[model samples]
Target: MIIGVVLLLVFFLVNISIGSVYIPIPQLIHGLLGADLDKASWETILFLYRIPKAITAVLVGISLSVSGLQMQTFFRNPLAGPYVLGISSGAGLGVAIMIMGGSALGITFSSSSNYMTWGIWGIIISGSLGAILVLLLMSLTAWKIKDSMTLLIIGLMFGSASGAVVSVLSYFGNAEDLKLFTIWSMGSLGGISGTQLEILSIICFIGIIPVIALLKSYNAMLMGERYATSMGVNIKSLRWAMILSTGLLAGSATAFCGPIAFIGIAVPHLARMIFRTGDHRILFPASALIGSCFLLISDAISQIPGSAETLPINVITSLFGAPLVIWLILKRNLSSEF
Candidate 1:
């Protein structure tokens, strides 16, 4: 626990310390401690932009990791992740609808109002609606089907459906809106603001608290459904709670971060490999810490060296995560009896 906490802090510091402009640690700390801000452009950049960006990275990391771990535990599939299942696709679909359609719907904004607030809420509402819709469809087939692989296929189909809609929406959108949408889809941690960050914190903690509170049930769940029932777990109710939690974490992160890829799926594997246990108690928090570290590192790299330009956070994550995922699959296949 101490190691995890320390790593979280280290990564967070790195995230805050490095950006398009360089701000020394001492100066950054002084500013954070309310010192006079009378220095270089880097100081202003650090206090105003990089700090918020880093915080967003931490929150996004926690949300995606927790969501990924829960989905893996719920499905009993090591490969299950928010990105893989298309939950982010739902969130993407939601974001596309809002940024593209908001003008037509007269959801115009004043320069004085918080645009981040509107964007965050729009993503949450749209993403949650899409995620819940998919969940409901999955629930309808839950009792009638017992095949995990088949269920995975259904989830993929739902995700593809959401993606198809997003493509069509893009097709008819004006060039300006399409450019905006494309940039958003590339993703970043810099987009979230202070107020919006608080909202995300509240929603993500509300969802994750229940899953942590039900640790014993999740442990039992890992032992298999029949065994879990033998031990008096309320299988049906538990399923709903897990689904709700996944939606809240996955949807909110997706809404804000613009569909970050791989951390949800990748972090859990890293956690498991480190802890060498299937225990959710240890795995949950471990995943959160590792997930945060992974994203912070990615964000740090996204800030190009000696240049004012930075790559998208999403692009960096995929570059790292995709290879890890491929390696895991190949390792699993090599050991499989089939």
Candidate 2:
């Protein structure tokens, strides 16, 4: 965990230094410290752009990784995650409704290309509601079904249903709305600044508190429900606690940055691989740090390190994260980890 935190701080600095004009370590630190820098533009770039983007990457990393860890623990399935279990898709559905279908329903937010351009809270609220709706349904389903695979399939069904709704909305949307939604879907960590950054920080902070509180419960849940019950763990309350945490974490990520793929499912396994343990007390913080580093790495690569042109952050995550996860699964037999 100490190593992970140190690595995260290193990556945060590295990511801030890597944009169109590479700011060397000295200049980056000087600018961040409010000291006079060689280039005036460097300060503007650091304060206005790179800093917020880097912070967003960290928040996203923490949110997705921690939430993913909780889901894996609760489901007792290595493959389960917020995205895998349809939480992100549900959040995406809510954003989709606001972006593509809202005008149809008399909602009058801006159609600007900027992500959630009209306001900060609108997308966050919609996305949270959407994610909570799906989680509520999944909780109800889990009560009737103890089989993890069965629950996973039901989650996939919910994802498919949400995707179908999004498609229908897209089909009817005009060219402008379609284009805006398209950009939003291709997640970018840029343009989250000012009040947006603070609000996102608050959202993620709220989500993480429960994870910290439930550490002991998560460790017990690993042995099995009957064992956990015998240990005096309230399985029902524990399940809902995880649900609340995951909804805020995953929902906020999707709302603020769009649909980020692979990190949620991949990071917990990565934590387990590094630590070689299923203990949430160890895994949770490790996953958060590693996930932040992973996304910051992704963000750096998306900037391409030098050129002004940038790739979509979502594309970078999928391109790198998918193959990494596949190799991990095949090499380690990830199912055994959980």
Candidate 3:
């Protein structure tokens, strides 16, 4: 835990320091301390932009990673994740409807009074509703399907169906709206402002409460449903909590940052490898810390340090996560560990 915390802080500082304009360590410290900087622009870049972006990266890392852990535990499938289970896609679909459908309906989101406030909340609520809807559908199926692999297949089908809907919406949408949705799908960590950051933080906080409360249930469930049931765990309620927590975390992250891939699927495994334990108590915090560090590093890399150009956040995560998924498949070690 201590090591993870140290790495997280180190990566965070690096993420903030190495953006477009490299701020020297001394200047960065001065800006953080509220001291006058040699250049006013340095302060603006550090406080107004880089700091918030770094914080968003941290929150996203923790949210997706922890949510991934919950999903894997709940379904007992190594490949189960927010993205894999269609939660992220569902959220993306909702955002698409709001952006594309709103235009079709002649509803302008950005021109109205309190547009920023309404716009952010609108996306969040829409994303949450979409995620919850998919989760509920999967929950209902989970009752009849005893096999985890079948449920995994169903989740993938859900993702595909949602993606198809999004494509149809985009095809008939306005050019400007299509462009906006395209850029959003590309994923971004730097787009969030301080206000959006606060809202994201609160939603994540609400989602995490259930995760923390259900740690015991998660540990018991790992032993198998029969054992968990014998121990008096309420299987039904546990599933609901898992779905709710995963939806809030994954939905909020997608709503604000777009459909970020790989982090949700990869981070839990990274945590398991690092801690070499299946205990949720250890894995939970470990995943959060390691996930944050992984994302901070990805954010720094996406900046293409010393260059003006930046790559999409999803691109970097996919490059890192896809190979990990393949390795897990080839090794055939999905349910063996947890």
Q: Clashes in candidate 2: how many?
A: 0
- lDDT, candidate 2, 246-323, per-residue tens: 878987898888888778988999999879998888898899999999999999999987699999998999999989
Query: Higher-TM-score candidate among 1 and 3?
Result: 3
In model 1, which regions exceed 4 Å deviation? 37-43, 101-153, 324-338
Off by over 4 Å in 2: 103-122, 132-154
lDDT of 2 at 82: 77
- Using Cα atoms with residue i matched to residue i, what is each candidate's TM-score against the true structure? 0.84, 0.90, 0.87
Write the candidate numbers in order of decreasing TM-score: 2, 3, 1
* lDDT scores of the candidates, listed in order: 0.76, 0.84, 0.83
Candidate 1 similarity to native, TM-score: 0.84
Query: Sort by lDDT, best first: what order?
Result: 2, 3, 1
lDDT of 1 at 150: 70
Say which candidate scores most in lDDT.
2
Candidate 1 C-alpha error for residue 244, in Å: 0.7
Question: Candidate 3's residue-wise lDDT over 20-115, tens digit each?
Answer: 899887777776787898888888888888988999999999999999998888877777787767788888888888888887788655354535
Candidate 2's error at 282, in angstroms? 0.9
- How well does candidate 2 match the true structure in TM-score terms? 0.90
